[model samples]
Target: MNIAIMGAGLSGLACAITLEKAGIRPAIFEKRSQVGDRFVNGEALLSIFTHPDRDNIATFSDQYGIYLSPTSHIQRMELFSKNKKAVIEGHLGFSNIRGREQDSFEAQLERQTKSTIKFHSEETYEQLLSDYTHVVLAAGDGAYSKSMKNFREDFTVSIKGVTISGKFDRYTVMSWLDYDLAPFGYGFLIPYSEKEANLSIAIPDIPKNAHVHISDLWDVFYQKVRSQLVQNLPITDQFQITQYPIGICNSPRIGNTYFVGNCYGSMMPFMGFGQYAAILSGVYAAYDLCGMGNYEELMKPLRQSYENSLVLRKAMEQLSNEGLDRIIHSLQGDWADKLFQSHRINPLKIASYLLRPYIKLKNE
Candidate 1:
């Protein structure tokens, strides 16, 4: 059976290897002349990995010269509204290195893959429809998957985001909390270097042309930086400013063509923990196409493991919002602080307010 995998990013390459392990040699086709350019992997955020094997894999920086930090330890985060005026802490999260580091991984994986990787300079969506029996579209961003109109009707997935990264101690490790400083989205202050940090803002599924003004978000950040945090990086230091749009794909996971990876729907909504999810999806796609009866049996534990991951994701989203609300409420004074502290710590209390599910489960 001839299998053609599309996009050599994390997802496509992973699928190729899985297929090779199954005694099938798949061909990888990348629209770019090179495999790793469109995809980036330096200081890429991996705030969202719960997989058991997550710690086992080496980063691209391990193979290539790019700077990639391994999973050292999970750090607790602190949220402060305008410097030390109000501070909140005791939250845990993680981030993986992305950007150029990711490109290096793809390059290395291409060499490690059992199948042939075809970097077609003139490759377009039209040719992909013509040449393969089974084509797994792992193409990310607007270029590839947007061409498939049917995909839109199936899922409600969109993201509006902003990110900026600069010299902050040459990619130092630190705790960054959502300043809760933005109106439309979340604000991020990434400590990249000792003398510089990137301030980021992200909104999920906001209109492309919304007239929402965010001068206030920066105003808060400006004042905060002028205070104690200023010692780390002043507000006037050179900074990287960017807009990042993020969303989850509401589409069904399996289909006729097997839309996988970012193409299937962002493996992660702006959290940027896409690499591993892409690799995992590729593993699932290979099992589907391989058609070995035992593959499904083999996949049971894998799916179960990832399903828990999905559960954790949903839970975290709920927790984040609740935590944000509690922080906002607590900033007023000690009475509110004591009341909001528990909510800040465990934001998923909404599970009790989940209407029928909780009631039914409770009754059960």
Candidate 2:
């Protein structure tokens, strides 16, 4: 079967690697000159986000044959609200570099694939669909899926971020839930190393946040970070994204074409964590192509996670500063420990079910 995979990001590369193992070498296409060809930043693979799987990297290697090395194992996470702060420590997850770096996740995945990636090619989906028997749409976003009338767009987000040179705890990640800084969104600091980190804020595109200036919010967030870290972190590079779609495809497979990665809605709407799901989607798509499994059936859990996260996102958007403060305060001590370390209970699913009624009431 002739196959063509779009975008050499996590999902595409993972698909290629898995297909190669099945004795099929798919044609890979990447718009960028090379893998990881974008702004360098830090992203976390939180264990809590991927319930039932405590360690993401280990599971990828053991189950999917995808070996990845994280920059640091996240041992601590600091959560800050408008009026309160909470710290959760333990085996939280992992932190990895994204984009352009030799050690980035994309670079690691690219090294595993034997298929040649046609870099700097502007090949359109319509053109590829006609030639290849099967096409995997892992274009790193939902644009093509939306164009194909398969995307279910829930919301859009504006994000601004920068790489800063400062003293940092590589194993500790920080996040803020102050509306004054990010409106219905949030801010985060993920460290790439002991001396470098990515500081960013994301604001959702809603009517209440329509008047929210990203630059203004960024300024406030920057000052807050400075005060919290007690350091004048010097920015070395910056990136800004507007109207970035965060949603899922209506179907994992439509006809002979398959959607994976962000195109498949691996990105959760709650806090934007989906690296593991994205990679898995690509592998699952490859499996379906090889007649090993059904893509739709394999994606059920990921889709459910997306729906659960959306419920949390809606509830968060309706919360006031005081409410956020209370939530943060509640997460302190034993509550935070149990929430992050629990394996028997899927916190996200439980929380979503509990919050559904409140969300319904608020909407009415």
Candidate 3:
């Protein structure tokens, strides 16, 4: 069966790689001139794959023939509320993958596909669907949202960050819940190396009572976190910032078209980490096409996890500053470990917890 994949991002590349491994070469189309250029947050460290049950990131890379390098292993995060702070430690880990560079992980993986990418191809989604036997929509930002009926848009996430030249604590990732940095989102620091790190904030685009743009959000982030965290650290001239929309889709695939990555809401709702989901979606798609596995069956666990993340996100939205402070402080030691590491927690229970506030309002 002939297949066509759109976009050269991680998901698309992963899909192509898997198909090539299965001896079915798929045609790849990328809008960008070079691989990884379109991905706005490619440099940020991803941690979910570091779990013991999961393949060690290095091993996974070796097994899949993708290039991924270890930067720093961070197992703890320092969370700050307006008044209180908490330190939660667990299996949080990260890797360094530079975007657009030749040595970057995505670039290396793209090279392995050995397929000619129709760069700057102007074929519309409908046109591609008509021409290819099967089309994989790896292009994110609601690429096939209108075509699919069950697609529900959640919100736009604005990612703003600057590289700084200074020593960053490689042992921990930092986050703050102050309203100033992000009225509806949070600020973070992910160290790329000991001397250089990406200081970024992911906030909702349309925040209540705020007329905010990407530039304005960066200014607020600088004043609230960067100014304090990197006191004498010089902000490098090279920096990147962008925004993308994310949502959940009940029907990711219909007929011959498959939706992957952000278009299918593979990102974790809590912090927007999606590389794992994106890659997995693509790999499973290849397997299904080759009649080796069921894509939906493979995605069941991730779908449930996404639902759980949404439940937590809703619960976080209702918290007052003081409540947030209390919750942060309460999460410590074994409690924090269990919360972060335990995947056995029933998502249904969390969903019920999120509904309690709304249920009470309906009764009143």
| Best model number under lDDT | 2
- The TM-score between candidate 2 and the true structure equals 0.98
User: Which residue pairs clash within candidate 2?
Assistant: 36-100
Candidate 3 — which pairs collide?
Answer: none
How many backbone collisions does model 2 have?
1
Residue-by-residue lDDT tens digits, candidate 2, 211-329? 88788888879988998889999999999999999988989999999999998898899998889899999999999999999999999998989888999999998999999999899
Instruction: Report lDDT (Cα) of residue 262, candidate 1.
Output: 66
Predictions ranked by TM-score, top down? 2, 3, 1
Per-model TM against the reference: 0.60, 0.98, 0.85
lDDT of each: 0.47, 0.92, 0.69
What would the per-residue lDDT of candidate 1 be over residues 195-258, giving only the tens digit for each residue?
A: 4444544433334325444544555554554453444333432323233322333342334476
The clash numbers for all candidates, in the given order, read: 24, 1, 0
Which ten-residue region of model 3 has the weakest summed lDDT?
46-55
For model 1, what is the alpha-carbon lDDT of residue 81? 36
For candidate 3, the per-residue lDDT at 362 reads 12
User: Candidate 2, residue 80: CA error in Å?
Assistant: 0.5
